[model samples]
Target: MITSRLMVLRRAVCVSWLSSCVRKQNYCSSAKKTRVREALTSLDSGSSIRIQGWVRSVRLQKNNLFLHVSDGSSLHPLQVVASSDLNTRGLTFGCAVDITGSLEKSPSHKQRVELQAQKIEVVGECNPVDFPFKIKGHHSLEYIRQFPHLRCRTNVFSSLLRIRSEATAAIHNFFRDNDFVQIHTPVITSNDCEGAGELFQVEPAGNEHSLDEENPHFFSVPSYLTVSGQLHLEVMAGAFPAVYTFGPTFRAENSQSRRHLAEFYMVEAEISFIQSLEELMKVMEELFKASTEHLLSHCAEDVELFHKYNSPAHREQVNLMLKRSFNVISYTEAIEILNHSSEQFTFKPEWGCDLQTEHEKFLVKHCGNVPVFVTDYPYDLKPFYARDNEDQPRHTAAAVDLLVPSVGELCGGSLREERLELLKTRLARTGLDSTYAWYLQLREFGSVPHGGFGMGFERYLQCVLGVDNIKDTIPFARFSHSCPL
Candidate 1:
């Protein structure tokens, strides 16, 4: 009887709270809150609306106060006109304001509509002196990158972020449309996807230097951050015909260059029943064209800003890439072209040596400045899992790399060795047979010829937007000696 009475009292209290909320919501609906982007495009004139945003610019005319405000809804800001008396000392650039106004057609030729403010409230104030960004200042990418916390307030970084978000969704949709399964690969792993040994080992905060002393090594053995999710995706490919993983991949690379980051995102996909590199290249080409097309169609204004301001030549390059089919050449042919070219290279291209950035850029230019697939790399240059071509004098693996004009080596992939005997011999030669015992077991159980490719998400953004620095493509950069929150 006591429990039933308490339940009735709780129901009455909930009803009272909901009724109060509904009353407040209906009252606030008088000046319907609207985003700048929605208001600019959809809302009709002569509608009462409320807008909240930071001040981008403040103009004082003879009798009127004009302020341009943005809520990061779009690249353009909404123009607000008010009486000069409404302007106060607290109203400054970078200051936040809540505005209730009537939308009206503008007399000026610049914009189609403008906001006529009836009341303005200064919700947040900015001194403008302490702010890293200046109003109407043209800051370079490097200059704005210093203030990571406040960089999104700038025009360039903000647009890049919006484009990045759209590109991410587009890639996922591309996979889903093609019947590919998405897998969430782990950040912590017992295996090194790449045997380069540049891994960021993880452990408890206090036991940084405990390296195999007596703590049982945390995970029983040393575990490190994954440099690539390809191996994990390969495991999923055994269960599903097509699978992909997109997530942050960490490496201990000590690079501060425009194209390298210690922590970056990768889009990796694996497909079963593919015996040739051509099948893999087809998917790579389709993904590039599809994702780029999506960005151009959906985020035209944001993408155009980069093409117009950053790289004027890239617009034509991108159009040509979409129109023409990508070029393909063997690794041996690429080396010959490099050796014969008159252009001086820092790292000389050789048949067995890995292709450097300079070499990759030259290859793309040699192939009419379009994306070129360089296939059949030397056996020694590839990782242990690459399928052996088994050619006589010149040994090579069935590996391929897709190199782009601006961004070299956009994607890398190979046909994985599915034969148990061949894989076992290769792993044993490298003294990693015991380490990869489970990987070898996959071949023994049931395996079909499969191939996959990994594309660097940052590099893809850099290519599409003509961004010179890879750091500018990602929201937060993690490089050597630097990790800003």
Candidate 2:
């Protein structure tokens, strides 16, 4: 009935707007705010265009002043050539300027076309001495990390930002195309989805009232910033056949490792009625490949910038990762391979122990460094939610971890324990039966076999771009003790 009503409503709306919704121009129709990249890409000679962007470089010739301006649309900046007769007032590197110009074919071989500016107005000025970045030469990613607020002005970071935006859209598109419902999962909740005890506590501001027993707590039972949305996606999957959530997830681990972050974006999804791990793995593989292909097609120039300048070694790895099928191995097999390896790992290879970064890297290396999935982990290592593999010789959970080249564990997931009594027993053993009683109710009322997976958004970006640190992928680096704006 609900779906029928939705269909009727959609039809009604469509019918009502047929006459009113005449086709409109596809692109932005603006005379004042022309994007620098678009203006450069669609250069029409003798056309007057007003463009605004931050100055990337300035070269003052005897007869002309040439400036490369960028508005973050592309890796390459728009070349604006202004004669000395024009007002070049307050023009400097990092200054935001609006230029009214006539587009013309470039006389020089460097650029296809250049903007011949008739007027130049500096909207915002930056003092060269105080500016953190130089007008010329590439700055190291670490050096730019210091100025998180202004690093977007840099070519490398700007390209990264573009890739991130495009990748996000591509991911959403893939899910939408695959008939998955997008869920806006809560950021704050009472339960720890991962049960890792690494949640960031969410509390009100400090005051005397906060200490009062009568109204002491914000949310009576100690609310926390969610560490994962997997559990919530699982809830939605009960109603919707397929559900996914992409949002910020918090963790309070204090490690200062390059991979650790206090907060990061996660893409999590839950699917109902998945019979086997193979079905779940197929969706994972498709999601990764489709979204990556979209990025390669849509953000070609931005990706090229990373290959040409940022991380040259990743160029071939990325191609192979996308072109070929991902390899798979059982956790037992991975352990055997690790044990027989010549390289001594920091963490010893053992049957029941969790795989560390070194161990995961070795497993990926064993498969020739393309993405690989390791399945059937020790039951004890997995969470209470994982489905039990009773048929296996040793106690194992139907859990899988997708490991990529640079980033060890790119994604983790499992077939959930849909059996009511089994879930109850597992939760009881973990002392979370009462806490997740509502979660158990889904199994009791009506539950089918279900499973889901979660990927760290930053980690995926790091792996794709060959970024050494997780901090570089995000707009702002948030770590154990650092939260710079």
Candidate 3:
């Protein structure tokens, strides 16, 4: 759903390790430094501090030289005041600077404190004529996207990166708090977990041995980038009570849609001894609520930038989601609701057909635009591992999908077919029985009833931020052919 320019910005300190390397150092190396966020909250007026960051704006008055500097510690920048004589040719917007100043109370009501500069030096020079981002105006997300290498310098994307970083930490904290063992699943695998045929086949870079179709494979068999970690988590489920994995996943999908991406992250969790879809849905719902609450509390300022500017109406939508309990409806009832709706859908609603994007959106809207769980899908629509519902007249699978207002399907999961005979019979229909012999073995020995769901990480970000495009949610977007540095 999203990749970003600030590839691995640590939420712990806003910028952390990268701030030291992001810009050139052209000032004193003796004095200790203070992050912009740390200085902003300091109550000691007259305390000496040095800050290094890109100059956001510069104002040269008759005697006073004011500069706004930010090191990505927070959404706001620190205001600096100096003598006009201290301002030089290099003190311009987008230029990185290091300044030693004393913290003092600000006369302006906009901020609590301002820096009274003792000395200022331009560490990294940036030409105003060539800088993609200007000093006086805000750039659109689309305009900034063309320059992925420098998008992090912009206020909009920087705030987004900070929020993304905190959201990641919050998720980790949630799973750890719930006693879910964090499992690092493999990125490359021999099995196609989604079975969608959208796998990105992997191979060596060079033909050292002059390999071909009949020759030996790299792993002696076909392998591709993982589409999901659910199957691997299931294997862990056999030995552990609960396990979760959060990592990148890939799909060789040929599209440039706003909601699609070639690579994204997923949070997959598997729980042993899970009996029904209700228990699985409870976990999913709780995760969402917990993560969102954490974001609202920790990333209030950063999130406000989106709620107040990017998507003004999203603030109310988020409140509604947290206030109301998610509604539940069966697949049959969802089809009935779609059939009775006045809106005409391109893919007509039917009994066994999978729900299209339009249908999913309509269902969410019908449920008062809150998150809704639609369960008990047709047997054929679900994957091979979906436990049989055993309703003879209308066969269905114990599967469920959590659909949000903007994002059609944020998560999908189902109870695995733990019965050895049923799983073997299902795999036999497609001649995959032998290929999945190890998977069958998981059920054979000490297999307990288990279920898990994988939520698209980027989609979750998009859903909360009300970001229109999935690309904006991520840092460096990887699509069909556009992979930026």
RMSD to native for every prediction?
Answer: 8.8, 8.3, 5.7
Q: What is each predicted model's overall lDDT from 0 to 1?
A: 0.83, 0.82, 0.84
lDDT of 2 at 55: 91
- Pairs that collide, model 3: 2-474, 3-474, 3-475, 3-476, 4-475, 4-476, 5-475
TM-score against native, each model: 0.90, 0.91, 0.91
TM-score of 2: 0.91
How far in Å is the alpha carbon of 345 misplaced in model 3? Answer: 1.0
Give one clash count per candidate, in the order shown. 0, 0, 7
Residue 479 lDDT in model 3? 94
Q: Which pairs of residues clash in candidate 2, taking residues 3 or more apart in a chain or in different chains?
A: none
Residues 180-278 of candidate 3: C-alpha lDDT, one tens digit per residue: 999999999999887788999888887685576676678889899999999999999988999999999999999998888999999999999989899
**Candidate 2: tens digits of C-alpha lDDT, residues 1-485:** 00000000011111000111211223332232223223324434665666667898999999989998766665666688989998877899999988877767777666656678888999998899889888776798898988899888898898899899989999999999999999999999998888889988878885744666776677778999999988888888889999999999999998888898998999999999997999999999998989888898888877877877788868799889998899999999999999998989988989999999999988888898889999999999999999999999999999999999988999999999999988899999989999999999988777889999999999989888888888889998788889865
